[model samples]
Target: MSLSKLGITGSEKDYQLWISSAEKKTSYPLTGHEHPYGIKMSCIPATGLLQQQLEGSTSASALQEAFLEGPQELQDQFILKPRHSARNQARKQQGKVSDKKTVRKSSLKNWAFGCISRTREVNEHPCLPPTKTKQLFGAPLEDVCDNDTLPTPILDMLSFINHKGPFTEGIFRKSGSIKSCRALKKKLNCGDTVNLNDVPIFVISSVLKDFLRNIQGSIFSASLYDKWLDVIDQGNDEDKIKATQRLLDQLPRANVVFLRYLFAVLRNIEQHSSSNQMTAYNLSVCITPSMLCLSNSGSSENFTKQISFIQFLIENCLKIFGEDITCLFGETSVSSDNSNITDITDNSEKVAGM
Candidate 1:
C-alpha cells in the first residue's frame, strides 16, 4: 500500500481515534502527543503483532482487507509513523512531571556492615590478595611478592576490604544499619534504634583510628601540622589512638602508603626477637578496626573513629617504647653512640669465664 492510502495526513481528531483503538488492542503501553508537525511516536511492538494476527485470518484477508462489511465512518482512521524516545522518557524529560525534589535513602546497615557485607557478596574471585600481583588494586603490601603488578579485581577487593575495618563494625553495630545512620545524620526524623549490647564500643572506636591513619599518611610532608591538615578533614593517623580514646571518653558511642615503612621497622624488631607470629597478631588487632572502617567507605563515622584510634596508639606507643629507642625508626636519623666502649669489652671478658 502507498503512504497516501494510510490516511496519515488528517485532522488531530482522526489520529486520536486511531491511537485510542490501537491502545485497546495492544498490550504495550501506548502514548502520543501532538508535535508542531503532527502526532509522532515510535511503533509499539504489539502493533506489528496485531497486524500479523489480522493477516492470518480469512475475515481479515490482509491488513489491506478494509472492513468493507462494516460501517464506513471509521475507514480513514488507520495510520502508522514512528518518532520520539518513549512516553516514560517524555514524562521525565518534559516539564509535565511532578515538581517535588526526590531524595535517596540508603540502609543504616549499609553504613555499619556495608564494607564486610559488600566484600562477602563478591567473594567469588579465585585469587585474593597477598598474591603475586596485589599492587594493581592499590593494595598496600609490605613487600612486593615476585614480579607481578596485580590483577585489577584483587586490587579492588583489597582496597575495599582494607578501608579500616575498625570503623565499619564500630559505626554499624551502634546505629543498627547504614540507612538509620544517614537518617540520623540528615536530621530527617529518625527513630532511636542504636544497638550496643555485646559489642564493645572501644574496639569499634579503635578500628576508626586505623581509617584515620591510612588517610593521613597518603601525603608527602615534613610538618606534623601539614600532615595534620592533610588528614584533619578526614583525620590524622599520628593521633588516631588518642582521638579515639577522647571520643570514647565523651559519650559512649563511638566510632596506607607509609604502611610499607611501618612493616619494615616492625620486621627489624622481629629479626632481633626471633619471632614474627606475635608481632603479626598484635598488628592484626591494631589494624582490624581500620579494615572495618574501610568496609563502610560510605560512613564519615569511619573517619572520626579512625582518628581517635590512631591517637590512642601514638600515646600508648610513646609509653610502651619510651623516648630513647622510639626515634630509631625514622628514615634519615641515627642513634647516639654510647661512651661505655671499655666497659662493654670488660663485660665480654667477664662473660667468657662463665
Candidate 2:
C-alpha cells in the first residue's frame, strides 16, 4: 500500500476514526504513535506479523478473524514495542524517586548524627595541644584511600543536604528514606570512575569522614539554626531518639556497618586524646552547628539525647554483626621502634605479665 493509502499525509481525524473503529472490533486495543510517512522505516517483526495476517484475507470477516486469531507472540510484538518494554524495566528497577531537596534532607540527618552524636568525650577533655586540636577540627584531610577525588556535584549535593543553601522544610525533624538513599547512590554512581556498588567498607569509611568534615559552612549555613534550636528547646528525648533511629534505619546496610566501624575507629584515635587532642567529644562537635548558642553545641541537652542515639546505634551494630571490631578493618600497625614499649594506658594499665 502507498503512504497516502494509510492516510499519512492527510489530517489525523481519519487516523483517529480508524483507531476508534479498530478498538470496538478487537479484544485488545492497538498501541503506537502515528509516524510520518516520509520516514521509510520498517520494524520487520511488526510488519511481518501484519503481512502474515492480511495475506489471502479477501472478506472483512476473514481479515478480522485473521488479525484476532494471529499468533499470541506476534500480536504482542505489535502491541508492545521493545523500547516500551525497556522503559518499563528501568522504572521497575528504580522504585519511587524522591526529589533532590528531600534526598538532601537524608544527608543532613546523617551529617548531624556523625558530627553531633559520635564525639562527646573529645570536646570536654582538658589536655589536647593546639596542633592536634586543629588537625581534628580545622585542617583539611587528605584523601584516606588512594586519593580518590570526589566529583563536585556530590559535594554540592552534600552542601544542600547540610543546609548550606537552597533550603527545604523539616531539616532536623523529618528523617531520610531508603528510597532517597538509593536515589542518591545512583546520583553518585553517575560519571564516577569508581562505581559505588559493593564498594569496600574501609573506602566507604574514608568517604563518610570526608563528607562529615565538608558539610559545614555554605550560603545557607545558618539556614536551619533556629529550627534545630526549637527542637533542642523542646527537650523531647524520646522523640529525638525515635527520629534519629528512623533516619538510621533508612540508611543502606553498607552505610550502617560503615558508621559502626567509623565510630569505633574514631574512638580509638581519640583514646590518644592527650597526644592527638581529638577527643571523642570534640569530634562530635566537629560539624559545628551554625546556631548561636553560647556554650559549645555539645553542652546542650539535645546533644545528650543525640549521644544516647549513638550508643543505641553501636549496640544495634554489635547485635547485627557479632564480629570483633578490632579485626574487621585493617588495624594500623604499631611501628617497629614502638613495639618494645609497654603500653600503660587506662584500658591496658594492668598488663597480665606485670
Candidate 3:
C-alpha cells in the first residue's frame, strides 16, 4: 500500500515497515510497495490508522500474534516497559526529598534555640565593667546583696547624686561625657576609693545610668516587665498602686531595696525640679530605659506605660515601697534625708575620698 493509503503524507523512504514471521528470521528491508499481514512497523510517525486497522481486521489480529511470536529483538524495539534500575532511582529520589524535609526541621529548631540563648544572655549576663568582686555590676541580686540592699556602685552613685545632683541643671536629662563615665566605672569596679567631689556631676549621673542599665536582668526583672506594664491598665490610682505593690512584693529583696532607694533619690531630685528641670515625669523618662530591660518587639505605648509606672513610683516614693524600705533598713522613721541618709552615707564613707 502507498503512504497515502496509510493516511501518512511522508515520502515512502521516510518510513520503514517490517513483517514478523512465525519462524525466527534475520531482518529484511521494506519494499514500500506491498501490504502485508504480521508486519511490525518502526519509525512510522502516524500510528492512528495503523492502530485502528489492527483492532478492526482479523488479519491485523493475526499480525499482532505473529509480532509477539517473532524474535525478542523485534518485541524489545516496539514495546515500552519499566526498568528495574528506574524504580530504584525513583526510591532514591524520594529519600532525598525526605532528607530535605528533615534538614528544614533541624534548621528551624536550631534557629529557635539561638533566639532563646541570645535572650538569656541579655537577661542574665549583660556586659559590665571588669571587677574583682562577684557582688558588683552585672552580678545577681542574691549574690550581690543578700541582706536586701543596693550594690556598692549603685548606693555610691545614688548617694553622690542625692548630695549634689539636686541642684545641677538637667541632672539626668543631659548626656554626660562617655570617657569620664568609663573612667569612673573602672575606678569603682577596681575597688578604688572614688570621691564624688572629684568626679564631674554629669559623669556621676551617667555612671548611675550605666549601673542600672547593666545590672543583671534590670531592677524590674525580665519576668516582671510585662506585669509592670499591666499596672498602667488599671482603672484608677488606687488600683494601680495596689497592683504595683503586689508586683513589688514579688521581687527579690535586693531589687525591692534598690528600687526604694533609687526612687527616694529620684524623689529628692524631683523636689529640685525648679532648679534641675527634671520633674518626676522627666526623671522617669530619663531612667526608664536603664531601669527596665525593654524588648525591641515592645510597642511605643508599652514604653509609655513603663514610664507612667516609674513616674507613679517616683511621685509616691514613700507610699508604695516605703514600708519595705523601712523593714529592710530598720529605720525608726520614714524620712527623705537628702543631706544624710544614714545607710547611704555610712556606705558612701567606705568608698568616699578625703
lDDT against the true structure, per candidate, is: 0.29, 0.34, 0.61
Q: Whole-model lDDT, candidate 1?
A: 0.29
lDDT of 3 by residue, 20-134 (tens): 2212122222233433443333433243333433555446344444332333532112211123433454466555443332211113233211211111113333568676565
**Ranked candidates (TM-score, high to low):** 3, 2, 1
Best-fitting candidate, measured by lDDT?
3
Residue runs of model 2 more than 4 Å from their true location after superposition: 1-210, 213-250, 287-304, 307-323, 335-354
After superposition, the stretches of candidate 1 with alpha carbons farther than 4 Å from their true spots are 1-281, 284-354
lDDT of 1 by residue, 1-354 (tens): 222333344443322222212112211112333221222222221335334445454342333233211223321123332323234433563352233223223353422112111111123344465535222112232222122222222222222222222223222223234443333323211223333223333332332333224432221111232233233344454454454334323321111223222333333333222222323334434543443234324455645544443333333443323333222222222122211111101111111121
**Candidate 2 lDDT over residue span 273-334, tens digit each:** 45445444444443233212323355667665444434333334434333454333333333
RMSD of 3: 24.0
**TM values, all candidates:** 0.20, 0.25, 0.55
* Error in Å for residue 294 of model 2: 20
